[model samples]
Target: MRFDYSEFSGDQGFLSPDELFAPPNLMNFILQYGEQAMDAMANLEDEEEQAFIQQLIDAGLLEESTDEDGNRRLKMSPRLLRGLQHRALLEVFAEMKQGAKEGHSTREPGRTSERSDGTRPYRFGDPIGELDLPGSLQNAARRQVHRAVEEAREAGVEVPRGLRLPIGITPEDFQLHNTEGSADCATVMLIDLSGSMMRYGRFLQAKRVALGMSELIRGRFPLDTLQFVGFSSLAETLHERDLPLVMPKPVSIRDSQVRLRIPLEQAYANQEKIPLHFTNLQLGLRQARQILSRSGAANKQIFIVTDGQPTAHVTTHPATREDMLYLVYPPSDESSELTLREALRCQQRGIRIASFALMEDYWGMDWVGFIEKLTRLTRGTAFYCTSEDLASTVVESYLTGKKSKKFIH
Candidate 1:
């Protein structure tokens, strides 16, 4: 089986350019699908496919090796993972540009005080110095014409063509300025790698966001510090080179039964093969705090990407009149409270938490309120989004938070 760059090119093909640039789709095909399926989807003849495969090897995007059984397979090279990350960042910035033209300003605090590339509806207490006079006048003129038409229709009077009315500028017609800014920041991104992330495909989205953020920081904010941490039963710091190799274990009844059947001896012997199935948010936060504490950057923050509530925590239990560390599983109030306590500890150390909740329904199990309270206690913010918007949301939140401190003071 071979890989073809043409498949992702913007020609008449099975995948559109937008879809090809999307990190989730590209990473899914490379990670989840087998080589044979990818070859079949590429639809190239054997000779063409083999040539493309050779090209990929020559370009250092893939490496070919044979197993002990003499079966050959292709594996992703670190270069390819880095390339995918760059592509994801480009796609996100492109989408942001499109959204800006459509009047969708970033939700960053104090954004209106930065500069004027566009205008937005003014609210009460907004500074008058930031108002866009031309835009406000145009809005008032449009409103006057609209009101005249509505009045004519209501009074049963004929509305004269090309009628003009005095324009009235009201507070409702006021506009505010918007702009983008940059700051030196240190960010630790914590991705949930528990069983639920795999079940709902949240893991894939989180990976894409991490990669995009890495690229964004490297290219745009060269002085910024960015770190990636994956957490399930525990938190482990991952470098950019280790990202593509990390895979979460899927949740399934069969897998659970198999795990249950494993003898304790054998399970301990094969510990490396087992994947973490519970969320240990406390450990993740602790690790993040440690990383940030070592950084000298004045602006430090944490971005947590998860789809559910905290399901595990670290605690000490009394054993033989001694305290022993224990992991609490299946999510209890104790776990949730411990997680919040850790977040507060981080907050006290001047670390801010920006949480992205991938699920939409907050009412289910009260997960929404849980996330809100978590962010609120940390003096940060929470965002509810879908997989489609995960990368953009993460990037924008970072940007918003980055600029907020600069303008607030």
Candidate 2:
């Protein structure tokens, strides 16, 4: 999963968390000496977490300063925040692997999913998706003029406001698209929150990618929509702000104790609520299919972010005596029933499925096979990204695929 960091530093000129910050951990330094820091630090020893805070500052992810008392402290940089926001946008519709191949209809007179043809006469019961806005307006105006003239003659009097044509569209007056047809496209993001995600320290990264993708779709594709599906035992929709916030570094014993008691520990870890399970790949895919169906788009797609072999399918599933003993450290499954169903469902709807595996170890040959099948079944792509280049790799893959779908000259 290791990647060459240099590959991410070229002309794209996008800033990283490091380039924008002051030298080091401003917050920890501040907490040690400052009086105004938040109460979250009450249980935290000032010097104990200094290194962690410093890492944030050195990475350019945070800014530091002291108040009148001259204490050390930190805050998130505006640049980093804006950059994260942009990343979120990129995540949603980074790239389309394919574009509409079908013809468009103009008769319906509104925006259609595909490329539009020229306009046509008004018709009754045409779909609004194909409506031709400009032509429809013109028809309304034309009808008004004709109605005025006819009324004047029939009434045998100069046309007054009542007799004059006040444009009104009847069933016969409605125009529709002349082209063939079109359909809207949709996508669903499946995030894995099994314990392995925590073990490999990728749970937070997955959340960021998920949020970014959702933001991208919301901003760019007015016609397209994205649904967030977090799967561990089962799948549930998550709000964008609820993404996980796992730190990039390790924690100490005292910190660990605090982490364990937090009412919603996962939420605190990632600064967002994330699902937890024992690597239930099957449950996740089943949830994804249900979510995709709700999108109601003409096309659907699924993206999976995971780092381990799926173990149990449900958080509450019963384990045998031997299996219970194994639960202390479960082996990666050689095959996954969930992945099989995921592939089938995606393929049935022409939905693409992509994977981003962010583990140092491949987990096992079985997991690799599952990843391969997931990609092949839906004809999507996959990437193995380590710590240094995970986000960049995802952005690259997304934008590249999107570019491929554009009708470039």
For candidate 1, the lDDT comes to 0.68
Q: What is the C-alpha lDDT of each candidate?
A: 0.68, 0.52
RMSD of each: 13.3, 13.0
The worst-scoring run of ten residues by lDDT in candidate 1 lies at 400-409
- The sequence of per-residue lDDT tens digits that candidate 1 reaches over residues 1-409 is 3445544545665755444343345456654433443344344458976786677677576667767977566666766776777766776776553433322233554543247556678888777888889989888888888888999999999985663755678998888776443346789999887777765566666777777888887776778889988887567898876665576645432332221222323433564654456677888999999999999986788988887777666654345343222334444677789899999999999988888877743455467667878977887877777766777777876664532211100
- Compare the candidates by lDDT and give the number of the best one: 1
Error of 2 at 255 (Å): 24
Model 1 misplacement above 4 A: 1-28, 31-51, 65-74, 97-182, 252-270, 273-275, 317-330, 360-365, 402-409
- Which parts of model 2 are misplaced by more than 4 Å? 1-183, 199-201, 244-277, 314-335, 362-366, 396-409
lDDT of 2: 0.52
